[model samples]
Target chain A: MNINFTLNKKSVTIDVDPMKRLLDILREDFRLLGTKESCGEGECGACTVLLDGKPVTSCLVNAVHIDGKEVMTSEGIAKEPIGKLLIDCFDETNAVQCGFCFPGFLVTSYHYVKTDGEKNLNKIKKALSGNICRCTGYQKIFESVMLACERKPLMNANER
Target chain B: MLDINCQYKSVEVSGKKEINMKFYKPKSLLELFETSEKIEGKKYFLAGGTDINVQIKNGMIKDEPIIFLNHLTELKNILQSDNHIIIGALTSFSEILESELLKNKLPFFQNSLKNFASPLIQTTATIGGNIANGSPTADIVPLLLILDAKLKLFSKSKLREVPISEFYLGYKKFILKRNEIIGAVLIPENAETGYETFYKKIGSRKALYIAKLAIAGLKKISNNKIEEIKLAVGSLNEYPRRLFKVEEYLKNKLVNEIDFADVEHFLQKEITPITDLRSDKEYRYRVCINLIRTFLNQ
Candidate 1:
């Protein structure tokens, strides 16, 4: 099946099996390797991506579903201002360890900062609850996102 | 770069095995029924593709044609009428949570389902898929059963309404026919008003864990006498069902005068929980009794 959709702000088309997973399509067809695949099932958020501005597990999304839809992987998010802010915060807080889960975390946290952008710990925990981290105990990750939320308003003002 | 190369090689090997499956995307609901009728072998509807995609990766579904239903926009809205709140079957859980109408009317449902399989899964898993899959442990089933929800079953020729309680015949077995698909779910408005609502999902973790056992309750007590009550249990029987005998036994009885021991006897008869991989039978039964006791005592 030939599927045409926007990938990371770019309009692209691919002829692949419609039943193929979005995760596989990104990594194999498009070579967007930032989205990891820890669990082939939807249990883990390692394959999380933005499908039309909503976070969804890529492994559970079929290639056919992405037809004419907008998809953004962590690689695309990293180029945005909010994504850069989150990365700086994560770097400052030393949140990366082993870093297998960081890409998924980055995408989910970027979403939180862009949409809700609250400094509340409970809300942050709930928003990132789907993505798991085996390293750093998640405290540093929370701090990094909270840092980004606190700095996001300032960044927006600067952009204006 | 080395890791990428290793992963790319594995994808090629798996891609060859998965390419045999065929996918059909119908432009309209009518086309869907017509296309499905022409297919000879087992075919599955791909709405949201949350469960079906996972089953495919696990090799449970192979070489079967999947009819894509996400494009059927007609079956994806939450509308309100004079007497009922009509929810299209393909309405995702996230969409339901964001609905102002549901939040205002069915606050209990919106609040309870906040932890339905994490925020990521909720974005793609539809309410119809949850019920159509007929899993006994489905998070939405117990809530729908207590809401007295009715399903609008659509076929090529006609549409019929069936109460959700009667929709299930056994474990993973439904009264839904081959040509029929769940069109919408009808929940009566004000059905939950002036009643105390309770929902508890006991799982291994707070998110991304299947329910070991779940209980949903609605009670209307007047002057310490039980006026109306509805209770349902999931993951504790062949299918999620209402505790009709228990509800009947407690109706019109003074709350202080009721004997829980007798109520337990009635509950034991209705639910036939078995030992499974997710939970133990004895534990499920005892926890259900305790939870029921707690709901009533409060």
Candidate 2:
């Protein structure tokens, strides 16, 4: 089946099984390896991606569901202003350890900071609970997201 | 093990057999029924695809026709009537959290939604799927039961309403027909009226832990007397069930007049807890009594 969807900012079509996991299609078919798959199940948000502007586990999402929807993986997030600011903050806070789970954290944190941006530490922790990090004990990750939200100006929906 | 004998069919797409299984995304209810009538082989209704995807990958499910309900606008509505609210079957937990209609009315449902799998899974896990999946540990089922929710099951020929309490037949079993799909959940508008409710899930940790033993209760005290009480517990038996005996014992009694020690012994007979991966039978039996005592004291 031919699946037509927007990746990053470009519209593209690919011939693949509709039941194929979006994580596999992105990493293998599109060669966009930014999205990682750790548990394969939805437990770990290592394969997190923005589906129609909401963060979801791509490992559980079917490619058929993305027929006309827009998918923003970690690869395309850096181009956005919020994504760049988050990356910079992560670097300054030493948030990225082994970097295996960095992309998922980046994508999930990007959506969290963009939409909620609650300065409360507990709220931020709850928002990012889906994504797991083994290297950083989450204090630095929370600090990184907090720093990014404080340093960057509040973005409009159009900016996201 | 799945018998993949006649289930595998090679579909020619773009001059090649690119797809292994057929996938249907229905745009409307009429289209969904039409497609349902035409399909000859096994069919699985895909909602959220959270549980179905894992089952398909793990070889626990066989190769079957999938009917995707994500595009049907009729099944995605959260409508409110004067006396009741109808939540569509495809409504996700994320949507449930954000719904003003549900937030103002049914906060216990929202409380259960918070303890559901995770934010990632909640974004895609639908209430319909949670009920249809028939897992004994489904966090939302017990709450729905306590809310006195009813499910609207739709077939190509007719539609029928079944109370959520009577929907489950046994372990991982529901009374739904093969051709039927859940349309919407009908919850009474005054289900929470004058009732103080509590929902608790004792899990290993907060985020992704499946409930060792979960409890949902709705209690109303009038003049220091227990006027009405409804209790449902899950993950302690073959299926989640309402505690009729306990509910009856507590009703119409003064809150402080009842002894909790005898009540715990009576409640133990209501459940058949078994040793499982999540917890031991003895622990489940003990925590349930403690939870009930705590809930009543609250």
Candidate 3:
């Protein structure tokens, strides 16, 4: 089956099984390795990606679903201004440890900052609740998002 | 014979781990029914692919044709009729949560489902899939049962509407016929008016956790008497069901006069909780009783 879609702001097409997972398609076909697959199941957010501006577990999404849809992996998000700002905040706060789950966190947090961008701790906690991190106790991760939320307006102004 | 207009492709991924499956994307609902009627053997309707994808990866689903239905935009809508809100079967939970009509009219229903399976799953998980899966722990079932929702079952031959409460025959067994798909869920507008609504989903942590047991209730008290009441529980029985007998017993009775012991006995008869991986039967049963008591007593 041939599926055509916008991948990371680029229009691309692939010939693969429609049943093939979006996660596998990104990694194997496109070599977008930033999207990790910790749990082949949707339980873990390690495979999270933006499907038409909404965060979805790429592991659960099929190749057919992505046809004519916009998909932004962590790799694509990293190039955006908000994504860069989130990375800087995480770096400054030392939020990452093993970094295995950082890509998923980056995508989810990047979404929250881009959409809601609230500095409230409870909202940040709720927004990133799907992503799991066994290290750093999540305090620094929360701080990093909160810090990014606080600086998002300034970053946007600079971008303008 | 399958519709000639329907497009389908059979593909086998060549590798160490190979999967051979035929995929069909029907252009219209009529085409879906026509193509489905001609297919022999196992096939699945892929709507959000949240549950089906996991089942496939776990090797629970293989060698089955997956009919893609997510792209059927005609079935993805939230419209308000004169007396009801018709939610398309393919409408995702996230879409439901975002609907201003649902939020304004069925605030309790919308708010209670906020903690359902994390934000990520909610983005792609459809309400119809949840009910059709027919799991005892399906969070949406108990709420829908309490809302007195009706399912519009669609088929090529005819379309029929059935109350959700009567749709389930047994565990994972539904009255839905083969080739008939759930088209829309019709929820009566202002169904919760003049009643106090309560919903509680007991899970391990919160987000991304399956419900061990859940209870939804709507009680209308007038002049210190229970005017009307509807109650439903999930993960405590073979399927989520209304406590009809208990509701019958409590109607027109004074709240304070009702005996707690008798109510517990009635509840015990309706629900059959079992020990499972996520919860113990004893805990589920006891928590259900306590939650019911709390809902009524308050």
Candidate 4:
């Protein structure tokens, strides 16, 4: 099966099995390894990706289902404003202890802030609830998410 | 930031495509049946891809010739007809949760929707998949049972509506045929809403826990009396079982004069739950009893 979709503001096509998970396609085919996978059974949100600007676990989303759907991965840090801000805040807040869960965490936070502009703490926590983090206690990650929201507008300016 | 258009045609399923495997997204059910008739190895109708993908990935499902169903716009709509609330089987839980008609008319269904995995899962999970999966824990099934939901199935150029009570045969089993796809769910309109309704799911923590034991009860309250009661519990038995004996005893009981002895006695005798990996039978049973008491008190 062949699928064509936009990635990081560019269009690319790939030929693969329809049943392959979008998670593997993004990593193996597109080489966007930043999208992490933990508890591949959708129980954990470590594989979250923004599907059409909403956070969803790419592990659960099949390659066939994403036919023409837009998928944003951690590799889009420079292209996507939230990605860049999240990266900087993650570094500053020392939330990168074992960074495996960083990609899913970043994508989830990005979708949350983008969709809900106001920095409501309660909503932010709810949005990031799906993505799980292993190291660097969630307090630091939550701080980083808050910090990213603060810097997102400026970082988005860089995109212009 | 990944925004893909749906206009691009669907590609084939990922596998050793040594054979001429086809990827068919029929816009209508007729076309779907035609494709299903011709499908070769391991045919599967894809909706939401929530459980199907997971099951396939886990190797629990090794044979499924995929048939994509999200493109069937006709199956993804919700409409109200003369006497029933018609929800296309493929209509998403999120759509149902957001539907004004569903919220206003079907509170039991709405309560079940609220406990659905999360915003992300709810976005793509469909009612059809819930019934088709037939897990003892399928949230929608028990709610549908309480609401007297009916299923409309289309296959072999014929259509049939099966009442929700008789829809599932067993665990991971349904009355569907080889070429059948759930067309729509016909829930009887005018369900009484004044009844004191209860929906309680005892899962690990919250968020994504499958119900260890979930209970849904509808008790008609009139002049401080329990006029009629319908109680159903899921993840308790092979499937969600109606506690008919309990309901039978509760009927016409004065709410204020309600003796805890009668309800508890009937509840203990009605449900036969099994211990599973999710929880122990003792916990489920005790929790359900507490729920019945709490609900009655409410």
Candidate 5:
């Protein structure tokens, strides 16, 4: 089947099998290797992607659902404010340790900072609850997410 | 051991003609029903696949064609009426958790979902799939039973509504026909009158932990008398169960007369739980009885 969607803000098309995971589509077909897959069953959010601006586990999600949708993969998020803030904050806090969890953490933290940027410590913890970081014990990662919220001036203006 | 099947098919998304996906996508519910109907055996339905994805990754589902129900538009509405609210079959747990309608109709139905699955799982898991899966510990089952919910099952040509109590036949079983789809769930709107309610789930972990024992209660305390009491307990039986003998005993009893000890006696005979990885039979039997006393004190 032929699948078309906006990836990294560019419209593109790919032909792949029906059962193919989005992780495979990004890596094998699109040649975007930044998105990794571990525990491909969706338990590990290593395959996280922004489906229409919301972070989701890409591995468990079938490519069929991406029709015409704007998916901001970790590769695509560099231009967005939420994504940029996370990147800056991660480096500041030494948040990425071995970095196997980088893509998932980046996507998860992007959405968290975008949605709940009040710097409410509890909200940050709750929002990133799904993004598991076995390496850093999460203190620095949590600090990075909080720092990202602080850096986003636009997110605060729109905060409810 | 369960046979595993993994032959996947491509489906087309309706209305979005310009873009397409490689994965199997049925353009319509009719096609989904027809395709699933023809499969001889062991074909499974994949809605959100939050619970089943783990099973699939472990090769629990081998090469059988999985019927993905994500594109079914008919299962995505929350229609309301004077008598009841009809939540479409595909209505997601995430939607339900954040819905104003669910909060109004049955508050706990939405609140309990906070612990239904992980936030990621809730984003994809559907309410219909949860009930249809027939897991005794399904977070919504006890709440649905307490709400006196009913299901509208749809087949190729007919639709019928069945009360939630009669819906589950046993463990991992329901009275649904092969062709029937659980189209909607019907729940009463004004049933909260004079009713004091509580929902409790004891879990090993806060998020994504399936409850070892979950229970819900609704009591209609009228003028110091227990006009009615409904008890729905999960993870303690083959399927989530309604404790009639206990409910019947509590009804019409004075509020204080129905003390903690009395409630304990009734609960002891109510649940017949089995041992599983999450819990032991003896522990369930002992803890469940004590939970009643705790609930009453609360």
Candidate 6:
């Protein structure tokens, strides 16, 4: 089956099995290996990716189902200004340890921050509850998101 | 974040012929019904694909003749009339959680929606899938049961409305025919107001965990007497069920006059709990009784 959709910001057309997972297609077909596949099941957010601007477990998403949709992975986030701010915050808070879970955490935090997530600690915790980070016990990751939310967008400064 | 040493397998089940599976995306309910009739071999109606994807990967279901219903615009809408609010079966939990109609009307259901899997899963898991999956631990089933919801099952030519209470026959079983698909769910307008409702989900964690034991109740008290009461409990039995015996016991009884011990004994007799990986029989029974007590007291 051929799937035509946007990967990150770019349109892509590829032929693959209709039942192949979006996670495997992103990694194997497109060579966008940044999105990790930790738990083959949807339990782990390691396979998290933005499907039509909503974070979903890529491992569970069928490539055929994503036809005519948009998918944004961690690689796409890193290319954006907000994504860069998230990375810096994660670094400053020392949230990046083993780094196995960093992409999922970063993608989830980016989606949360971009979607006007409340700065309230509890709300932030709840918003990021889907993504699990074994390292740093989540406190540092929460701190990173909080710190990221505090920073003004570099793009906004240019407008000012 | 483990190494990329994982082996990627085709979506085809082993020993099954790897024929190119045809995918059908129907635009309208009529088209869907017509398409379903023309299709041959095993057919699956795909909506959110959250549960079905997992089922396919686990090889619990074969991967062929999938008719994707997510594209059906008619099936993705929510319509409210004077007597009822009709929710399309493909309506996802995220949509339900964000629906102003649901929040303003059925707040208990909206609150129950919050306790479902997670933002990711909620974005993809449809209410139809939850009911169609017929899992004992389905988060939405108990609440729907108490609300007296009805399901509209559409076949090639006709539609049949079945009260949710009678929809489930047993574990992972439903009265739905193989050729029929759930079209929409109808909630009475009264489900929105004039009733005290309670929902409690005991899960392994706050999110992304299946319900260990869950309960939902709705009651109308008039002049210190119970006018009506509906109760549904899940995860402890083969299927979530409305406790008709309990509802009968509470009818016309004064709220303050009921005995907790007697109600607990009655509840124990109503539900048969089995020890499973999520919880043990004794624990489920005790916690369920406590939940019932809490609902009554509140």
Q: Which is the leading candidate under DockQ?
A: 3
> What is each predicted model's overall lDDT from 0 to 1?
0.87, 0.83, 0.87, 0.75, 0.75, 0.82
Candidate 2: tens digits of C-alpha lDDT, residues A139-160: 9999999998786565565664
What is the DockQ for all candidates, taken in turn? 0.55, 0.55, 0.59, 0.29, 0.40, 0.49
- Off by more than 4 A, model 5: A154-160, B1-25, B222-225, B255-270
lDDT of 4 at B133: 75
lDDT of 2 at A28: 80
Segments in model 3 whose C-alpha atoms lie over 4 Å from true places: A158-160, B1-16
Residue A137 lDDT in model 5? 71
What is the Cα-based lDDT of residue A39 in candidate 2? 84
**Candidate 6 clash pair list:** none
TM-score to true structure, per model: 0.95, 0.92, 0.95, 0.87, 0.87, 0.92
In model 4, the runs with Cα more than 4 Å from the true position are A148-160, B1-27, B38-43, B256-270
lDDT of 3 by residue, A1-160 (tens): 7789999999998877777789888998999899988876788799999999988899889887898999999999999999999999999999999998899999999889998998999998888888888887689999999999999888646551
Each candidate's number of clashing pairs is 0, 0, 0, 13, 17, 0
Residue-level lDDT tens digits of model 2 in B103-137? 88877677667868888888888989988888888
Model 1 chain B poorest 10 in a row by lDDT: B1-10
What lDDT score goes with residue A38 in model 1? 85
Query: For model 1, how does the per-residue alpha-carbon lDDT over B78-132 read when each residue is reduced to its tens digit?
Result: 9998899999999999999999999998899889999899899999999999998
lDDT (Cα, tens digit) per residue for candidate 5, span B104-223 = 776756776677656666677788888888888888888889888999998877889999999988888889988677889998876554577878888876555788988888876667
State each candidate's chain A TM-score: 0.96, 0.94, 0.96, 0.89, 0.91, 0.94
CAPRI-wise, candidate 2 is: medium
lDDT string for model 3 (B261-286, tens) is 88878887777776789889899888
Query: Which ranges of candidate 2 are over 4 A from the true structure?
Result: A154-160, B1-20, B37-42
